[model samples]
Target: MKQLIIAEKPSVARDIASVLGATQKSKNYIEGKNVIVTWALGHLLGLKMPEDYNKDWTTWEMNTLPMIPKKTGIKPLPKTRPQLKAISQLANRADVSEAVIATDAGREGELVARWILQYVKFKKPVKRLWISSQTDKAIKDGFKNLKPSKMYDDLYYSAIARAESDWLVGLNVTRALTVKYKDSLSAGRVQTPTLAMVRRQEEKQETFKPENYFTLDLTYQGLSGKLQLKNPRQYKERQELEKLIKQVEGTPIKVVDINEKTKKEGAPLPYDLTEMQREANARYQYSAKKTLSIIQRLYETHKIVTYPRTDSKYLTTDLKQTMKDRLQAVTVMDSDRVKGIIRNGGTVLQKSVFQDKKVTDHHGLIPTEQAPRLEKLDNEELKIYRLIVERFLGLFEEPFVSTNQTIKAEVKGYIFLFRQSKVETYGWKQEKETTQKRVDFKIGQVIPANFVINKELTTPPASLNEGTLLGQMEKHNLGTPATRAEIIEKLISSELMERSNSKLSVTPKGKQLLTLVNPSLVTPELTQKWEISLEKIAQGQLNYQAFIKEIEQETTALVKEIKMSEDNYVDHSLTTKVCPDCGEKLREKNTRDGKIYVCSSEGCSYRRRKDPKLSNRRCSQCKKKMEILENKNGAYFKCKNCNITEKLDPKGKKNKKMTKHETNRLMKKVNQEEEQESPLALALKAAMEKK
Candidate 1:
């Protein structure tokens, strides 16, 4: 009997089959002497929609909401059903006595294979292939040491709980809001709280006020060194600062104290997906989503980088042998400087990069078993490869050493202090110039401290931009590394946050939404509560079912309160123009080229593009009026009211064109702006109303 092997994608399946002696290849699978390998296109099946149960409930309505089915349903996507069916057939074949699950070694990947097996009722004894790297040696070794499938049953259970809970909460709340607000809106456990974060930031920024403060700076020619105030700001009142400056004018400074300490700076932690994404965003101005996609392609397609979505930034002790191999891979790419660092073969392994406590889901992103052949790749691939190389090299280098000095003095009874630093050793910082730009200070170098006695100075009020505010939020546990990028992206995409010259500003629409919404619903504290509970559930310290029941009870009371309240939701996108066909109101939308007029009433689906050419050209009958209509065949613009169709070339400069993908992406923003209900917001709002 042959052993059946299943993989997450065709690329992985082919590689596995090659190592397993599977030479025969097909469109979606491969074959070996004793094993037949197949692939699932990411997810072969997903939870079914409410419409699947009954077509009558296709349109969302409040009465039919809270549609919680006792047993969840699943269906294969129509376009990919044939491929899934083939996989099912192979798994249940008469000659196949056993099967091996070779999907990704993550919780989600486990669920993907288990669900397919459950749906197909494949009763064959199963084993799991849990290798992170897809190199020939790793694949062969993994097959030689296959583990029983039951070992990962707990992981599968945890994943199922998460998926089912998301479905229950997301679908019900999404339907409820859409029905109540008369707009197609969605809410998710991840997406809603994410949106709330953006809204709150906008609110805080809009209401921010700047305060004024004054300081007295003392600059004097000193025999030892120049002197300046340590903590400059003395008072908020101008009269108070003037009194201090007057006392210190023309005062001879005296040295009070001097202190020095030697310090060593440890090497930075290896690259995790989040930290790498943040750096790439800051350095290259690339969005988080774009970085993830690029790294995913590098890992799954090119097999150069290790897993790209990891949270941990440390390698396990077992992976130490591969470190040297990884370094050698970089050397093959012609980086002599990095190669020279490893040529000495000195013992540089430190406990900092080999800790098991720091790792959670997986280890940090590193080079895979494959060599870094960046020249063979594209621009995006090369950029991602360079990041991995730089980080990997940084991990093996020595820690930086420096001397920190603090000097103190008193002039006219006014105590002043200053700080300076000098690098004792370059260490790992020598690889990057940006990392090496440390300010150097000698033990007794007398220099200007940027302050003079009797000089007027003012302290600017503290303010935070999007980036700094994000940093603050992260410190408070308001968002995770994975979610931060998405939150920022959503804020910008929703037009709740705008960037002008790299600074974030809140829009009028955003301010209005924040004022109208319930405060507790849009605060970071709500997510903090959820995150605490989520961590408990992950650790098996909290019951998953009990958590869901609590949420349901809270949601039940909240909805009733929202209905009783007198708060009115204003429709921001209301338009005065009537639809030509149905006489319903026409809503304005932002198209790729410009604004477009679309029908507001459901099922009408009428749309008309704004004609710039017709608006520009003057008509003969009425010199002020412009042509408004054009024939179907690329001809001339004609007046809609006058019915005058004139033939002309279509190559005028006034014509605007855009691809369908670009047009749809721009239109989606307008659609989202028209929506008022947020799933997470609605839930919290409903609960707060009851309170």
Candidate 2:
């Protein structure tokens, strides 16, 4: 009998089918000599919503909350029901005797396939094909040595516990807050804590008090020293600094001490999703979500990089043998880097990069053994690819060697120190050294004297950007690398956080929600503690049922506290604009596209885009074409990605004048341009061919 292999998505299923020679295409599957391949488009089902179990749960009433059921049933997702039906039939086909799960080889992936099996009631023996990348060779190897599906039972349980617990806590708390405050506020097991982090940072900014301070610097011929008073480096008062400046006005500065230490810094760990996202955010100013998307394309579309969602930065010991192959793959791109890598890595691998016990979900993100064509990469993809390449190359290169020089100077009794760093070797950074900027001071050497007073103000902490937010999320265990970007975006889209250029600032509405929610709900430590327990469940150290009970208990306490609180919640997003239909104040809300002003009245259904919507014409500011949209009033044009808008000029007076023929011709030209692949698309095509 033939075996049926199910993958997480069609793209992945295609990879498996190609590798296994499943050439014949069926309705929702591919057929081979003895095997059939089908795919579930990501998740075909989810845990049943509370309202699905009880009709009363549909209404937003606090009385019907804590919507706990004895057993949460699963249902087919409406959008992919047809595909699900097809896969179900494929799984139960008489020719199929056994099944294989080829979904993403992670905790969430296990749940995806297991849920499909449970829902379809597939009774045949099941095996799992677990591999990190979708490269042709990796797929073949994974299928060659498939593991029993039971091996991932604990992982599936862990994922179910997380999902069901999120539903319990998120749905109940969201309902309670919405009912209490009469605003659409959401609290998640993970998202709430993530929002809290941004709120706390804002609190720091609001309370910050900048203080002005002054420093007196004394410099002689070749010696420089900052004047000190009472052993403090800077004078808190300008008057105090001036007094110190006068005291040492004529004192000659002389070198007191010079010290040097040779130091070496080991290469950084390989790219984990968080580290890569952080680097992209810092260097290229790309958002975490953007970095994740780019890297995912690099992994899946180009087959150049490994899995993008991994948290581990250390490779397994088994991967050590394959390092040379990975290195060889990049030789065509940079032979010098490959040569350097081979020189150092031909022996034992770096001790820091091969710790098996340190690895968790997957090995660190690395390149597949597919040679890259650099000329095909676009600007952004190339930037991210270079980062991964440099990091991977570092694993095979020597540690960065440097010598640190510290020089000390004294003016009368006051003293100051300065530092100079010299690179002994650039090793992995691959930078050329042409000049050594250094100041040499001989002991007891005196130089011409001068004093200057420098004044500065104490600065507040930097505003939270995507990079900083991801770092904060990682630190607090607020969300996984795969989910942190979405959480931040969610906060921004919910009007709880605003993305200003690069920094993230909490909205006033965000603070109000934080105040109204249960204190523990916003604390990341609670989520982090839950993550610890979930890890246990995945490892079979704890039963998922016990974990669910804990979440239910916590949910009960949180709901009780929220109900008992005498505090009042005011809608901070309430705007003065009155809804024409209901004469109630409009509420400001944020969406992925832009801002919107909606009627506060429950059934009024009146809404307006804060950023004006479409026009077929171009924007005057950015000179980009705009979209046209209509609210209750009239049609307007807006450039959603930029700040450009205009009301309808149906008379064609304000818009660029164009005859019908000319407009049609220009539109045809634009359509032709849109049909072609982007530059990054060219890169993906190149990498795919390399395979």
Candidate 3:
């Protein structure tokens, strides 16, 4: 009898199958003498929706809220039902005896396999394949040392609790707000607190009052020092500051004291997913989601990096033996730097990096032993790969050493301080030395002073960009490293917040959402508590059922609060134009594509593109761009500049325009095609059909 192995994705399944000699490939699985490999498309089964429990709960009504089922059931996700069936059939095969869970080695990964196993009612013994990297050696090592699946049952339980709790709170509260406010407002355990942080920063920006301040700088024989003050850095009255500057101007300054100290800074910790996202955003202005995607590609497609969704920044002790191979794999990218480390007796295995106790489900993001093909990588992949590789190499280098010097001078009794740093050793920084002018001073030596006063204004707190927001989320324990990016994206997609100039700002809808959402839901404390509870569940310290019970009680209270609250939500985007289908006023909403007019009625699902589609055709009279528009008559080109209109040819020329009916029919056909092709679209369509 062959052992069945299940992977999280088709690409991963192929990798495992290749390593296990399962080359006989079929449409759904790969077969070999001793193993049969199948795969799950992320999650093939999820918690049953509200309607699945009770049909009346499907409608969004104030009274029907807090739809907490006594026993939550699992259902096959409609789009992936075929794959689920394939796995089930393979599980029941006479030749397959025991199963191996080769899905991702994390809490969520455990859930993916456990849900499938439970749904298939696979009573055979189960084992788990846990490894950090996708390298062939790692895969072989993992299978050789497979552990009993029961060891990770607590992790599976925690995953279930997290998913069910989120559904309960998010769906119930979202339905409550949407029903009362008549707008598509969504709130979640992690996302609401995240939005609250952004809203708080915006509030600080709105209420900020800038104040002017002045500083007195004294220059003497190429030596410069700034006047230091005790309490207030601001000089509100310019007259008083001017008197002080005048008194200290052109006076002889005496060097009071000088202090010199040598300092050493060790290399920074390796990249956790959050830190990686933060650094990518700071350097390339890539969104957190964008950075995660790039690194995930580096991990899955390139097979160069380890897991990208790790929270730890330290490697396990076992990885010390593989450091040389990992470094050698990345030598192609920076041969000089990597080879130098190798030639100089290899890496030092710093205690900061190789701490097994600090590692969780997986070690830090590091390069695998697999050498990368530089030409195969795109620009973004190359960047992320270089980032991880450079960080790995830094672990071997010595600490950065420097000498800091501080000098204090007395100019007419007004004290001034100057500081400078000189690098004693570049170490891991690898900085080039440059000549800089130096000032030598002795105690009690007097020099002529040149004084200048500079005026500055106090600045408000900077807005939160993806980097800063990720930092905030990490600090608050708002979400795991894997889920934080999705939370930020959800805020943007829900129209509660917007990204501009690389900073996140609250929209009018976001501001209103904060006011309308329950106060408890809008604070980080709620998520922090939930995360702590979830962590305990994963560790087998707390019962997930009890925690879920508490969530149900909380959800009931939150919905009741919304029902009684007098606060109102006004749709600022509402317009006078009525929806063509529902006869309700259309709301002009800004989207990434452009502005769109959506029906204001909650039950109506009618929307149209409000922005005119620009066409290559130019106006004959004005020789400017023309807008392609259609009406009941047919397709035509119009120039807003000169009020010129021209009939488009109906013969479907190379530059032919489609009539309104044809355009809509074509869009419908395209959407239908996409629905057929995309799993997510199919799932959404299935849900809509059920409704």
Candidate with top lDDT is: 3
Taking the candidates one at a time, how many backbone clashes does each contain?
5, 8, 0
lDDT of each: 0.64, 0.79, 0.84
User: Model 3 Cα displacement at 690 (Å)?
Assistant: 9.4
Worst 10-residue stretch by lDDT in candidate 3? 672-681
TM-score preference between candidates 1 and 2, better one = 2
Q: Pick by TM-score: which candidate is best?
A: 3
| 2 versus 3: better lDDT goes to | 3
lDDT by residue (1-691, candidate 1, tens digit) is 8988988777788888878889988776798889999987767777666676766546556666566665667776544688788888787778999989998777667877888888888898999998767777778888999999998776676566556666666566555655565543444455454455555655565576655655544333432233344545445677765666566656555556677899887777778877777667667766665677677667766778877767678878778877777777777654765666777572444458887777765788888767866665767668877878777776766777777776766656666665656777767677343322333334434434334333344433333344554555555455455445555655555445555644556554455444433344456565567556655665667776776676565455434443344554555555898998999988765444566777878768788775544455555665555564545765465666665555564556576587886786685444323212222233333332221
Of models 1 and 3, which has the larger TM-score?
3
Model 1 / residue 496 / CA error / Å: 6.5
Which consecutive 10 residues in model 2 have the weakest lDDT in total? 675-684
lDDT of 2: 0.79
Q: Output the worst ten-in-a-row residue range by lDDT, candidate 1.
A: 671-680
Clashing pairs in 1: 218-452, 218-453, 219-452, 219-453, 558-686
TM-scores across all candidates? Answer: 0.79, 0.87, 0.90
In candidate 1, stretches whose alpha carbon ends up further than 4 angstroms from where it belongs are 53-57, 216-233, 236-243, 332-334, 431-521, 525-543, 590-596, 610-630, 633-691
After superposing candidate 3, which stretches have Cα over 4 Å from the reference? 246-252, 411-413, 432-435, 580-583, 590-594, 602-606, 613-691
